[model samples]
Target: MIDLLLEMFSYMFLVRAVVVGLLVSLCAALLGVSLVLKRYSMMGDGLSHVGFGTLAIATAMNAAPLTVSIPIVVAAAFLLLRISENSKIKGDAAIALISTSSLAIGVVVISLTTGMNTDVCNYLFGSILAMSKSDVNLSIALAAVVLALFLLFYNKIFAVTFDENFAKATGVKTGLYNMIIAFLTAITIVLGMRMMGSLLISSLTIFPALTSMRVCKKFKTVTVCSAFVSVICFFIGVVISYVYATPTGASVVIVNIVAFLLFWATNLTIGRIKK
Candidate 1:
């Protein structure tokens, strides 16, 4: 297995995939803690769907996909939040409505323009071959920015996540912080889309936080553990995918599911022992 992994790393595509995957996993996990605790986890799914539409249009126009997708998705994130907050559409319903509509639009665009080729399949399901050197560099810069902002606003986010009403009462500007979360999540989703696919990218933002919650109760502990677990699972998944020729996104999601189950069982056992 070690020799096989070493050989796999020798391939430039695999190396680039690993690099992007690790950076994305860390960003997703960090933001995941806030989203889950705030009960806004599905926001990632919604933004990813919007990203899919933007990416499809970018592809059709022959533009740099990330350059076009990032801003549009971020704006969509803000719009989703605003609609959820003020519009009569409400939260979950609004997310479902926007998500399904964006997905449909993406499908229509792809059908009309590209006629469902390998590139479309890659965007929908992900492909290791999709990661170019330029993509990796941009991912690194974006991931760094996300991490820095998260750390800078760590305390404020913690307060908002736990009790938004109280945070607002104390004048924390919960809305701005919420926007920050949305923006960071939007960036993470766009960066991850090329590797994890529009369909599965949200898992990276969800599974790590939920799995870590099974064992850790405190916010800080859970955040740290989630980042570690996310990176590890992504590495394992990429290796397995490369060795066995499995779909990269599906492989990573499967690894996350297995980890979540293991964590749940271990937590249950520990509780029984304590009792």
Candidate 2:
């Protein structure tokens, strides 16, 4: 395993992929706990679709994908939050409406200009080779910002995630904290989309939190466990991807599925033992 990992790291592209992917995994894991608790886990999926639309437009315009996509997707996140909070659309329906619209727009733009090429395939399905040195550097910087923000606002986010009404009663700006969560999630989704794909980026923000919940009851324990699960699964997935020549994103999701099942099984066993 060490030899294989060393061999994988010998390639600059692999090194970049691992570094950026790990950081994104950490960020996703942290933010995911809140989203999962709040039942807003699919926010990542919706924002990713919006990201795809913005990326397609960027590609057609010969502009930088991340630069163009970030603001648009962030705005979409804010819109999603507002619609879910105020409009009759509400929650899953609001997510579906925006996500489907963005996805359709992305497809139309791709058909008109890029015409489903290699770059488009990479954006849709993710490719390890897609991480240029510059892309890795930018992703690292952005991922750092995400980690810092999440850590700094941990208490406020925790309060809002668990009980928005209570938090508001306690004088916490629940709306502001919720928007911050959405903002962080948007950035995390975009940072991961290059390596995880727009279609699968959300799994990073979802599976770990759910897997941890299978065993850990407390929010803090679940959060910590989610981080560990995410990082370990990502590493194992990368190894599997290198050995089997599988798609990185799909491999990671499979690993996460296995992890979730194992945690679930373990929890069941403990329950039966107590019974």
- State each candidate's clash count: 0, 0
The most accurate candidate by lDDT is 1
lDDT of model 1, residue 250: 90
Per-residue alpha-carbon lDDT of model 2 for 120-140, expressed as tens digits? 788888888878888888999
Candidate 1 stretches greater than 4 Å from native: none
**Residue 5 in model 2: lDDT:** 82
lDDT of 2 at 117: 80
Name model 2 segments beyond 4 Å from true.
none
lDDT tens digits, residue span 11-52, model 1: 998898899899999999999989988888899999999989
